[model samples]
Target: MIASSWLLVAFPALGALILLVGGRRTDAWGHLLGCATVIASFGYAVAMFVSSSLAEATDVALYSWIPVDALQVEFGLRIDPLSMTFVLLITGVGALIHVYSIGYMADDAGRRRFFGYLNLFVASMLVLVLGNSFVTLYLGWEGVGLASYLLIGWYTGRPSAATAAKKAFLMNRVGDVGLALAIFLMFSEIGSTSYAAVFAGIGDLSPAVITAIALLLLLGACGKSGQFPLQAWLPDAMEGPTPVSALIHAATMVTAGVYLVARAAPIYNLTETGRLLVTIVGAFTLLLGAIIGCAYDDIKKVLAYSTVSQIGYMMLAVGLGPFGYALGIMHLLTHGFFKAGLFLGAGSVMHGMNDEVDMRKFGGLYKRMPITFATFGLGYLALIGFPFLSGFYSKDAIIEAAFGSEGWQGWVFGGAAMLGAGITGFYMTRLVLMTFFGKERWRELKSADGREFHPHESPPVMTVPMIVLAVGSVGAGFFFALGDRLVEFLAPSVGALSEAEHTALPHALIPWLTVGLSLFGALVAWLIFGRRDVPVERPQNVSPVTRAARNDLYGNALNEALVATPGLWTTRFAVYLDNKGVDGAVNGLAAALGGSSGRLRRLQTGFVRSYALSMLGGSFLIVAALLMVRFS
Candidate 1:
């Protein structure tokens, strides 16, 4: 089993290498290998999850990788409920996304490169989830960042893709700085960087230092998870392939932040101030993302903002401390299923329409593509936290935790989250109605230039993944029955933090009320847009404020001013100083010495006669002085 754990990660890497070496000439093999690798890995994850659930604790530790007098780190794999859950998420959702990409990138010229990067991403994510220590985790962390950079810039010829990649890389670096600082603090405080050592040392550290470390880790989480201020890159990340967006933005990479916080629950549990900061940041980001998502017109952009919002909810639950860990992890699992399905469904629509992404251009697509529309529509409902769906169970859990007897602050944050849910429902309905319920708006399809275009269903390869994910999106929540088992499984690694009591609110009432609120939101959208008999008004038809919101609320401009401008100015300033200040000083000193030598050059100008006379005069003066001294 220990060796098999390594194989789970190695398989995808092997697939990637094979595709890189052999798939350049034949993409069929590339897709086949990529799909097969993820499926096999997913099979292993499932087997582990079931076996670990049924049997006693199952962990496989390899030989020590880091050994010191005071500290030791081993290369090991844990099959606890936490790691098992994430493994399923990575491999199951990842496998479907890989399979879907086969159809999504069918006509692309660089399909081989695409699959290669995709396989690499899956492998790195596996490394991240499987690692037993911070050092092993960091290896996967940096690996994912590298893969993201490549995949984001897959369309290197497009300026937007390049720009988005650079933005993501730089923003993540800002967060990574904090992560690095936290690692240093951990090593200094505990004398080790292993997860076991750090958790074990939590009680020995000062509360202030603990808070600082947690906050630093939170900063890094914010960057990876697409929280506010650092979140601007995700929307623009749609510049990559649709499958890339589905996999990284929706399913896996962005969720790393939540995983990081959950894995380090012990550190945050030690400090009240740290918990407060996490809650505040999480709440703020949730509301901010929901607000921004309400105004986006692009299909993928809307989903991107939703990803940010969903992660915010996860952070909120995690911030509630050890008690919320189960909630956070549960949401992570369900979110993966639903969001990945939605993004892929959207990708299928794009594929059918020849890559049109604007919601305004589509209408009444249900008749044209029933499977795509039904799956996407259902996915939207799941995201709105409607009753009985996977999202409802997880999201309601967070809201319930927020409203517990802790303080009004939790209640306030929870209330705001509830409002965000309604807004989520409203905007999703607006998207669905605008794109699929009204009259067909793209008359160009009937025109001479558009005659060649015909709406068609995605191939079975794509639909199969969508169907599987949709099923999971609808049903994965029932796994929460194993919550206690989960806690026990992770206790050795994550340790115990004060467990939060489940909310006192009746569970039966919560889902119904939230769903009612969501329905009201959907009704508003239906009334405002769905019933329109003629072409809807343009964005300008709305108020200037609404127009601004539709334009990402000028978040892009603020990002340029706050992040881009300063970064460029600093870089340019450093370049100038190196060229003009430091180099110029050395060159200036040499020039000055040369000038002084030139000024004194006349004295040495080939004057042999003058030299001889001066020597004779000096000799006479010396002889006269000596004679005078003798006479005296």
Candidate 2:
């Protein structure tokens, strides 16, 4: 009966306020309050989705937020298919995380503050997705970044947490510069920042100007999405709680980039160069993250790398231009399910153990936590684009869209993504077998009984979400193919993307090829890492060349030399120049003038007799000179 549109955002924000103010005294109620709000929002999101699904285009404008003489910004809620889809994702998956956190953070001293931040993040993300215009969207953009900073540094005691938070904030600030400039450009050209107005103006702009604006927007997306040089922060961001990891990395924060690009599909379509840049960046990031993921031993760190890699896939779809939007969105939704499940399942394992995250320490956990193991196994399989799961449907579609292109670009991108998938399978298999199938590697680890809690299961709260997400991971893809109704509903909002076209391939070919590729990758992984005597450990005794990959190669070294070292040395050099060069010159000049004044002081001696003699001598000389002049 209630208006499901605004309620989706408003309730969570209200809950955040309650938790912020009263969480300290509420004990378990803090988490209860937070979880309740997300659940309520999720219900509203579902209602809104169902309602919008039936309607043409659902837009609810509250009032004009920012109005000038030339342009007006209306505060409104838009629940078209695109926003509805994301809204359901954010709230539905987000609620599960909130429930998971109640168990995950039960013993933490800052539990209240943690729930408060979590609720605030969800609220902000809703704002981001439901905004009717760019100005409204940016409020949520900045808000989520701020929440990420807070949650990433939740454990202020750890230096790594603080450092990661700083890196995220600063890197995002750099991207935001480009975003701000792009906004200004849009206003200058279109006279409005509304999605409707800017998109309409995009068709009229010169290709060169459109490319510039689109590239600037891409810069912002890259930072928010964690691509290329800006991606360093994501791996280190594991310093936060596991729920924080699930929420930020998997479900909410990182997906903002995909949303931005997809939303701006119209503007990006105006420039060919901009579209190509998107594809290139996406392909590179996908490979880069997968390669790095292969080297990590830490469970969460591997997942972190995997997140960066998966996001790269989404970016690649965006690069494919309007033709790739549905594929990108589909992948984004499936990704939320599987990735969040993976992070939560990992958290459950960590909970069972005494916060141990290294895969090297775990072995044969399948017998202990069957639900967690099963859910996570499905998640990994889904993420690797294994057939029948959600990721397979979405990933294959994108690749197919790539191959359906006019030139060799499709082959180039499809090949790269396929290779990345193979590596993805290899690492994930190593992760799974090492943690759940092998002999327990760490005998030093003992249970509370001083024996071993070798195969433990998480509580009901944690397992419930994992189960639900796992189901979603396996089933979400069908919604895209079967729900033309959904496509029609969202058509107007994302009308820009409908411009690009692709070769109509047999629908059967994509799933089959994706299944074949994924199976091949899995087989390779099984052959390499699934062996019983697999060298008794990982390939730690590799050649020097191979060792580089395991050590993150020279990535850290490059960062130090390129970014950190230069900044440090520049600061020291500037200090030296100030003290020894500029300051010294000023001091030297002052000393010389002082010394000259000291020498001149003798000429003004305080001797009355000497002063009178000099005066008489001067008078005699003057008279003699005057007489000579007169004679002449």
Candidate 3:
């Protein structure tokens, strides 16, 4: 199975091709087929992971992918600890999402086509994590981007969905440029893109070149992962179907950036500058997402921003280099379970409540939809680092790792991570309280869809997956963090963990401090939202801070001001130059020639009298010149 790991990608890719090509013919059972493909992939991944040697990487070369003069790249699979870990996550979580979508999307007219896109999404992500070379990874990278565009725009009739799809695609391209450049630099500097070769040859290059490569890779990571400025597209992506949000936010697209950074551990390990910049982006975006999440009435968008914030934690972890690489991957795994469950729970809520997403309108759901409430609540606990939950172990480890950093680096990054935890608790608690624990606001009136708000649980298909993920959310972190097993598992790929030589704070005290802050934040949320009768209508008048949080801290407006407006002016200027500089020169010369030729053309007017007069004048001039010469 390890030797034939290519089958993992093939199953889903083949399923996508069949479903897409079969078209309407597959409508009867296309979703089941999609689920089977991913489930098969997951089973195979589990087998390969269990069978394969964990100490060293295994290369399964398929064929020569690129055979240029100095560039010999093989299409191959790297069945290693790191890649296989992602493989299991993608296929396992992906398969569950597929099953959940069956119930989630059953009534939609485009269910068959949706299944096809889902298969494509799983296949592309498999290729991304399993690839042995940079070119192969890039192929998967672009495929994921394209598949996302298709999935996000599945509701083509909706103008908002189309706009969101375009936004995601275009914004991701900015980061793609960085990834492409990094690959080009790799090939130019090291003469190969194979992981083994690049890692081996990287040290031969200068520090400047290595740092450039690392930072460039980080830029691409930010794009795919929704860090910082690239973070805006993520929440807007919730305009797509809820299943798409769960898949993209939890198990697939957004996680790609964290995978990219973790995979490039060798490059990042050499450059403090690269790692420092990465940490800065992560710490800031974590807070930014948390802040924005607090003001959203929409449940899905709240989770979307939470995805942004959580990915920020992963980024912060991986940015710590050897000190936190395995910790990052651990958190990512645990986050996959809880976050995916949370999103699906949101979907279930929508399913029950006539497709409404506003938490302002959702209240006392726990009694109505016990299954969804139980699952979402557990997932929420995991997300907010509730004791004994998955997030508790993984997130606490990261905070401790942050505090281990020396000097101001420790406090700044540690402080950011700690503060982010508190904000995360506050906002997430606000979401849960408004959604499941408040007054029965939905009983007051009809929902947005003009239906009476009769909330119920999702069907067995969807609820089962939520339960499974919720289970993982509760316990996966303990298993992964136990004895540093995942760290040991990932050591061969990301390098062994290296503890900071010194610490700015007591290591044992850090977890206590983190839990204290998280609980305090939760307490504050209870005081503000839980103890009050929530209004159904959002308030117009608010404080500046509240307003700013509601507006995503003016991120979109800032983007318009800094990027869109300047880009628009630059484009207009280019058009103006093209019209005046290039076209004007060419057109002016053409006009000059046309004018000169018009005057000359006048002299050639066809007439017998004109020809005769010209001949007579010539004869007279010749005679006059001869006479004058003879006289002289």
Best by lDDT: 3
> After best superposition, candidate 3 residue 78: deviation in angstroms?
0.6
22-118 per-residue lDDT for model 1 (tens digits): 7456575777788898899889877766654523324467788878776677777655556666888788889889989888888888887788889
List candidate 3 stretches off by more than 4 Å: 447-449, 498-505, 588-604, 615-632
Error of 2 at 14 (Å): 2.5
lDDT of each: 0.80, 0.82, 0.91
The parts of candidate 2 lying over 4 Å away from their true place are 1-4, 53-75, 444-455, 483-486, 496-503, 534-539, 543-546, 573-632
The RMSD (Cα, Å) of candidate 3 is 2.4
Positional deviation of 386 in candidate 2, in angstroms? 2.5
**Clashes (N, CA, C under 3 Å) per candidate:** 1, 1, 0
Model 2 scores worst on lDDT over the 10 consecutive residues at 497-506
TM-score of 2: 0.89
Ranking by lDDT: 3, 2, 1
Question: What are the per-residue Cα lDDT tens digits for candidate 2 across 1-632?
Answer: 22447788888899888888874586667888889999999987776555545344455787888788877889887666678778888999999999999988988987978888999999999999888788788889999999999999999998989999998898888788888889889999889988878887788888888999999988988889888767877888888999999999887999998898888888877788998888888888888888888777889999998998899999998788666776787788889999999999999988887787877778778888899999999998889888767877787777777676557886788888877877787788888887888676655565444655445799898899899999988887766556444345556656533433523443457656666766776777677667763333456667774577666656667767898799999999999999999999999999999999999888688999888998999999999999999999
TM-score of each: 0.91, 0.89, 0.96
